[model samples]
Target: MGGAVSAVAISSILIANRGEIACRIIRTARGLGLRTIAVYSEADRGAPHAVMADEAVMIGPAPVGESYLRSDRIIEAAQATRADAIHPGYGFLSENEAFAEAVDNAGLVFIGPPAKAIYLMGNKAEAKRRMLAAGVPCVPGYEGDDQDDLAFAEAAQDIGYPVMVKAAAGGGGRGMRLVDEAGELADALGLARSEAASAFGSDELILEKAVLRPRHVEIQVFADKHGNFIHLGERDCSVQRRHQKVIEEAPCPVMTEDLRAAMGSAAVDAAKAVDYRGAGTVEFLLDAAGDFYFLEMNTRLQVEHPVTEMITGLDLVAMQIAVAQGEELPLRQDDLKLNGHAIEARLYAEDPSRDYLPATGRIDLWRPAAGEGVRVDAGVATGMEVSPYYDPMLAKVIAWGETRDVARTRLVRALKESALLGPTTNSSFLVDILQRDAFIHGEATTAFLDEFYTGGFVADEPGGADVALAAALLLDDDRDAAFAAAGYVSATQLGWSSAPLSPIPLHLTTDRGVFDIGAECLGAVWSVTVGDDLFAVALGQRTDHAVRARINGRTIDAVAAISGSDIGLSVSGKCFRFHRARPGMEDDAAGSSGRVVAPMPGLVVDILVKKGQKVARGDALAVLEAMKMQHQIAAPIDGVVTGIDASKGDQLASGDLMIDIGDAAE
Candidate 1:
């Protein structure tokens, strides 16, 4: 190890990001007795991260190009607050070489690797070249600088079919396309270029052979300015959807001691090749035969770093700060030991049934899970609005235990207990993945979702018991309100009539269908009937947002959020939404309107069809960009385009009409 250099004193740090990552960095900085400053876009003015910071500065508007990505504004915020350092936490300018250099030029400590290292590793094409020179095994593909379409086509033919078109300057599944044959190469290249330019401000492309069904394992490597480097085991991120990681666990189940040593040493060599500093992750594609090839190096801390921290008992953010202050690493490779297994699942505000389309709305209820060995890193709260301007990830739930099975069980229970209402979420889907036989046996590959859920995930409809519970809860709430209005001393006097009370009737609507439910209050218990099924529900502990009740002698805990006529409830790790059907409110011709509407809030990237153009069912109509992903809107029926209400570059809200289709004869 090299001798210690002059230490850079840092008293305050301005976090140059938002959401859970910003909150995560602020917490560590605060624990280390450092003042934290947060910069936010107008859309995130009162977000959790902004509220948690000692001081907040409004950087710019909601669009990242106008706000978080503006390095000058972030530096200005830090200087204005008299902060000594800037922590670009995980996204936005975190891996931007120019931003890192700008911070250094401004005399502020950048709590990450040097600008030179970022430049060398930020681009996938160049990073592959460097890794190859350093004797690191790499996937066989093309990373040449020829920007011609013909060049890429020829390269694809040379590399064989089923290749990946990747953005040279970024990751996170954006600007990446999988091509199955030569016929799909052109469109893949065009779409990948468009996304790459939009997301990373670069249209440079790289081609890699699609390593089929490989496990995505990455090594968490840390280095200090004193030249000491060590890697904290590996994380298996094979469970994915749309090329993005959904679940991550430490100590990849398939890893052997020899394989670990080889991969870890390769990761350290890659870090040393770039003179890397602070936190970084070297990703690899490990095949079934135990051969691992270098994928790329993320020059900044990864989003799934928490699992490694849990198993290794280390605080990576603290290590980054210490390295930024010119401190030597506290431990060596031999000193590190993995104590247990840990798994983390990302909680996103999205609808899996709708092709994972991002959802936007107010978070009416937010209750993260709490238990021994469970950790929740969340950046949302009740009443906060989830805007379309940023990522849909709301939080990360992690659990650690003495074994992988214990960790998996704890994580499943925690997800089931957590409650998030208003916008649809993938919490239920996450629970399903954790309980899968393949996952439980640690035999999952990157193609797990493709092989199992080829038709996409469709959530199960609410059962009779669930519907009855919702109806009963509504009835009880109404009774309590009425009793208070009548100046009753206590709500317990609601059903104390000397004679038997009549049953109350309600019609509740869900996506499955409408149900006519009858509920009667019989002393302390409710007799709820849905169709022919009857349930005896006895109320227990109750709160404004949650209730514990025994249904048919089986105790169940549930949380609910009431907004007007809609009720959002969570039970058994699944979410059910019910709407109290009002007379004269049902539309007779809702689905046959022949109108195409935006499924979620997004910006129109392209309008493929124009007025008077005939279209067949499933014909491409338009392309929408929402939450950094592209969604293709297709024609619902065979008809002529009668009218167009949205244009390219238009920002649309959910359910906004985008096109009109009339009968082919018309």
Candidate 2:
């Protein structure tokens, strides 16, 4: 039970984060009758969170290292805005002990776990030691001070192969690797260390036996100064990509009542281990034998906290704020209970088929799903630019239902009905997972995505006629009165022109590959054909980036937005980007275009080749860092480098020429 302890009065709170999480915290703070202050960089001047807050302050540039991660700037913003408390809404400095201390020293309440708790639990190795002492099961591995490469390799051999090399100081999926063989240990170690040092300012690593097909289940724990602690059930975040969770559901389907109680008790002990206050999470790897090992403790709110809230009918943020004010948790362990099933799908601006590389562009259309049991939390709006400076997650689509099946179905429907254009997303991939039998049967594990769907998730391509129709609508004068008028004409009478018009030939490239479409407009009707398929379309009035049309006697609703030289089309929540390729401009299979271009906006972190250097196909030519991840831009073919246009630290836009690689001599 919590006790009445000294508490600081708070009226206004400053959120030291951006995007959806900032908007989430502000909503809760407003509900609690508190003014919310938001901080943003130049890139987020018009972001939803900044505009939604009671007041906003510009901190620094777009780069997070110079902006959101700058604790001093965040504190200054809070003080200048006359805020009483600061909520570091996950990521950035949310789990940084120094940031917590800074907030406390600035005479403001840190709406999270205490600074000492964060410090003690932040280091994965030390936290494992603490968990072991507290009788919490830990994965078999080494967390010793001797992090010598040789010693680590030996420890991996001792713990056995397929051990996970992880940065002790970092969260998310960063600074982590799974070494399946002895041969892979060295590379995994070096890369993990480098990523750790870069991300968390510490290269210290810990190795653990990679639990095969384990379930990633975390308990939401809340504590108060009065010494009260409670676990709000468990969330199975087993569906992941690149070590980051993509889907999370509360009241894990596989969890029995006894298992839930056992895990909940362990989580409570974990919170008590650090004397944690406010909200935190105790993550564990649940094995097939029903045994669970402590993975790590997140000393802040989690990105998937909404699912927990949906199932428990609790506002975790509000509870966090109250606990920060020294108020005891209203519910005890016995009083807390789970209700309806809840699931959350994280929509990210990344291509699932391309190793999850991030995408950046303006959101031409953003219409979240709407209906009962559906809740969409997003910080983006139509025309908002999705930059390379932050996480690629655009929003969280959460659904709740009376049963797990009901919830799963609702979530799948919501994902299919939600619309986003411009940047590619994993919406379709999420729907695929929800529909998979492995997931529906509640049998998915940490290896579910890789093991079951090895080919990667791909959305179904629209019909050839549909594709041709979309292209024709985009190229046609959408505002033409004749087009709107023809939409109302009888289908039988449509396309009956006394004088036939010349067919408009268009070259198009889409996710489904390239096609040559021909269109002949007859008043409001258009004859669209792609290859052998022909489609008669009645074009309706256009609205902003969307259009209403009837194709082959069937009405179709779609969004058509112009993005650069490409056209983006969205129908039934699936989006496709098509480049209008000129007939003579298409590159041959040999990539004779003779140019190596940046695939997306990013910072050139490394130039692997110099001018005049010879390279082969698939050779790493350079490394570009974007969305806090590194991507290798490889050579398209065997060629000799003729020019280098970018250097380390150079910011590049999508299509910016990186280097010129002329064809190699025979």
Candidate 3:
């Protein structure tokens, strides 16, 4: 396909993906004067990527298996759109060898590596074998065909304690588990196999020695069908949670020139060994001693590709299109140079305080940060619903600077400046990580979160000042509504009273608890009291999406979204959601009420308890699968199961009752 005769002129391209990556690809394709087609599920009909594309096609339902993962539907959509090529952005079908081959059979260019390369690297076991044959350093492990439990037990014993059981076809941490001892091997294997089958359609298992505290560094390599390959540099993706990267940065802080050259050479060799084309990442586990071992090769652009693009000053997507068009290398290795440092933070719609449980709700407000060296790759907007049918990642915040410190500071500030409310997010948690000394000094390793946040991250309680601000905002909204209802009456006469009006007592409920607040509106200013403290707030320059307010002589610009009685406010890089409490309308204590509820909307995969069964506190009661991950619902208290409201294969919404537990005595 490299020769001139095989060159396929491409004028239109279809993106078989969704969210920010799809939008990102469209931007580059549009810049290159190519018509862009987007395919979406029913849940994404109004999504940003679908709206931004030159043309859009509805593929199927919301479930990935019925939509994004349907190779036939994707190819049909491409043919219907008459697109010259299809770009499978990361995740779904990006690394699927069969999908790539299917695209080729359809006579449409697949804007990625050849199907053979994808097949060779898609399976961890096969990839390790090939890398070993290529003389690449790999971790000591077992990749034999024997899938028996006894075989895994023996392999773990030989590999010593703390072995990693991984899915052969897994990415994004699915179907992976760490076994610290032989005792936990079976359970780990079972869970891993289930997740692997659900996520990648493969339950093939492999064993590897757990590289304790190694930094996850990967080289970004690009190649053309003409056999030219070069490495851009390395990205340090050491800070992670649940084995998924949370933060990534270019020019690994601990990297040396010699080490970069060594790793780069190895990565290029890995690419050449497979005759890989377009963009790929060769991940490695770098020890403190600077020794690195081959991890695996990702055959598509990574979620963190923005970090590389920021430092390289080149569009990797554009390069991928060029390679798909049978173009030669744009530049040689010697001409390539890494410019400033860049860092990326993924913004996910999840609750860090709740073990990072994926959240689904309407996005009440979305105001991405904008400034020098800051870029936001997002696919969400105000009033949009974050569906539970896809990944929880909502956006990516990346910053570039001349130095690592500069980039770190800018990213922290940018994360704070940007606002996303309604659904719980990890924004504040990300800020805390940026401020951690371990991360700032560049000493973070794979165990960074495990060592630092042993009990998981618990956000600080909203302070009195924030509560006062919420009360003031709610009062201001009420005043504005009153004015608008009065047929555009003058603001000065709207709230004017002949006598002193008693402060309106309100109760605002937050995750911390219910707060009793009193707000008194006096002309343009407000006197809000939370507990014993009082705040004089004067709001200035209010808009639909933001407001400038002075609280006790300190002026602050905050993004605000008010919907009915619910209020979302962001100020000084902190976000707070407040629900106006009414009489006898407080939330029920679910645990004390003996109600076992689903934490989020998902399908019930398994029910571990039966009616009349006695269970202790913290016992696993059921498992709910959502967004490609399994979350166990645990018994909140010791009780007898009086009723089972949900059955296996049932789709449940957030807070839907799954089981009813009665007192143990019953």
Candidate 4:
């Protein structure tokens, strides 16, 4: 470890990020009686982070570049608030060396590793060099600072047929490409370089050997200025989509005591090489033969830290603060004990099967499960709008139990009890991941999603007739045309009316199929009959932001959410997310925006065209990335790029811009 600092604690702490992570840190700081301040963009004026902090400061507009990325404003806010420490939550300026340096020069505690450590690890190539020097196993490839595509591709070919071209400036699967052959090397390297250039403002790249069907395993390491450091075991983050980790669990199923000891010692050595401090993670790709290679080290708390906390019964955030306050590590390497198993599932505001497109809308029902061994770290609430200006991650649902199976069961049960009503989400898909035979058998890998997910997504997807029955029963209100004791039809309007009664039409949409049917409600129970099928449902108490409805005679569980004029129901083994019928027929399937649509709420980072510009398919037309990640919106086909919309920085929503096309054949 590095030399000890004089002291680390300060009077107050300024959180340098927003959303659920901000809220999560606030809770920890408040529990420790440490004053906390929150910073937000315009779109997050009423966001969860602002409401949870002791002090809230308005930064800039919704665009991250204008708000979160502006390190000058953040430092100003910290000084203005008299905050002596700055806690950069994961994302934004967390790994930014310059930001850390500015904070240190301002005579404030950075509450993380030293600026030099951040600088060294902030660059992938340099970190790999440090790791190799520390005798930590690294991928058998090149980490030299090389920007030449041909040179890097040649090196990649030397590493063998399958290799990964990655951004040397950052990690999280961004700026990463998997090349299978020499012919595919150029395109992969170029794309990786461009994405890296846009996201991290650095096009520098490194080449590495791709572990065939490797499992992503990372070790949680912590160090203090007192020259004490230890490892908190490992987490398996193998389940991923588009290179983004989705499901993470502690005490990997394939983990062995010998392997853990070997990797743990190596991780400790790596941290020591950087003289690291505070909470950080050393990630690795573990192959089938028990061999592992250093992937990258996250110099900040990971999104899956709660899983580590659950298994160890340790408040990692509190520990981080204590260490930053100059406290020495209390436990030795041998004293660190691993107990139960824990798992975390990321709840995102997106449609999983619809290319995992980010979504935006008002959260009508925000229900998260809270029980023993189940914890929810969430940012938004009921009535909150999921803005396009931020990450689609709404919350993280973590569960703990004595055994892995128990933990998985608890997580699935907790998720089933949650009801988040907004735009289409990935709740059902998360459940599917948990219940998959391979996932259950501990056979998960980075390509697990690629093997499972097919295409497209429908909201409230209840795929079978059983789901339809459950939905119908939940909405039943016992309607009849015959006269009742009040001398009028029971299904008629509340006020006296002489007009002839007509059948009431109700629509139900889910991931399964859309249903246009009739319904009736009777006290706590509802009955609905579609065609020859009769259904009955008993409503349960409101749990979270959803209404649990039990279908009579069906063992399948169901949930229904009422948002505005729309009702989304998940029943049987399927789901249906649909809107209330309007004047025109609905298109169940829409085009994939072959031209270009804003993937998330973001600003046009750059515009590279004007009207009548000829462009081919896959050409970089415009760039629109939200939540700090850069997305290159490319052209879909050969056509004239007609009608340029905005300038360098214009905020946009999905489908907000349309590039006109005359030749449909193109």
State which candidate has the highest TM-score: 3
Could you estimate the TM-score for every candidate?
0.96, 0.93, 0.97, 0.86
lDDT of 3 by residue, 1-666 (tens): 245435778999999999999999999999999999999999998899999999999999999999999999999999998999999999999999999999999999999999999999999999999999888899999999999999999988998989999999968888889899889999899889988998999899999999999999999999987878999999999998888999999989999999999999999989988889999999999999999999889999999999999998989999999989988878889998899999999999998888889999999989899999999999898888998899999999999999999999999999999999899899999999999999999999999999999999987578887888788888776766666796665353454523333689999998667888888977777889888999888777777677888889998788888899999888787888999998445666546678888989999989999999999998999989988888889998999999999999999999899999899987
Candidate 3, run of 10 with poorest lDDT: 492-501
Query: lDDT (CA) for every model shown?
Result: 0.91, 0.87, 0.91, 0.78
Winner on lDDT between 1 and 4 is 1
lDDT of 4 at 17: 97
Candidate RMSDs in Å, in order, are 1.9, 3.2, 1.8, 4.7
Query: RMSD, model 4, all Cα superposed?
Result: 4.7
When 3 and 4 are scored with lDDT, the better candidate is: 3
* TM-score: the better of candidates 3 and 4: 3
In the range 1-666, model 2's lDDT, one tens digit per residue, is 444588667899999999999999999899889999999999999999999999999999999988999999999999999999999999899989999999999999999988899988999988999999898888888999998999998998899988999999978998899999999889788778866776788999999999999999999999888878889999999999879999999989899999999998999898898888989999999999899999999999999999999989999999999888877898998898789899999999998877787988888888888999999999999989999999899999999999999999999889987888888998888988898999999998999999977887655676775586677665564323344586654322343444445778878887546778888877667788888888888877677766778888888888787765677787776778888888745534324466888888998978989988999888988988888777888888788999999999899999899989887773
Clashing pairs in 1: none
Which stretches of candidate 4 lie above 4 Å from their native place? 1-5, 454-460, 463-501, 506-514, 518-563, 570-576, 583-588, 592-624, 627-651, 660-666
Alpha-carbon shift of residue 565 in model 3 (angstroms): 1.2
Query: Tens-digit lDDT track for model 4 on 1-666?
Result: 556567655668999999888999999899888899999999889888898888989999977789998999999999999998999999888999999999989888887888888888889899998999889999988887556776886787689979888888887777898888999888787677777876777888888888889999999999998889899999999998767789999999999999999999888898989989999999999988999999899899999999888878788888888888898887788887888999999988777775676778877767677898999999988787887767788989999999999999999988877777656678888998999999999999888887766553334434335444444433332233244545664432342334433444566544334566555555444455555565665554444324455666554455556654566555432344555554334444333334455656777877776777787777777767665456667776667765676567787866676454334444
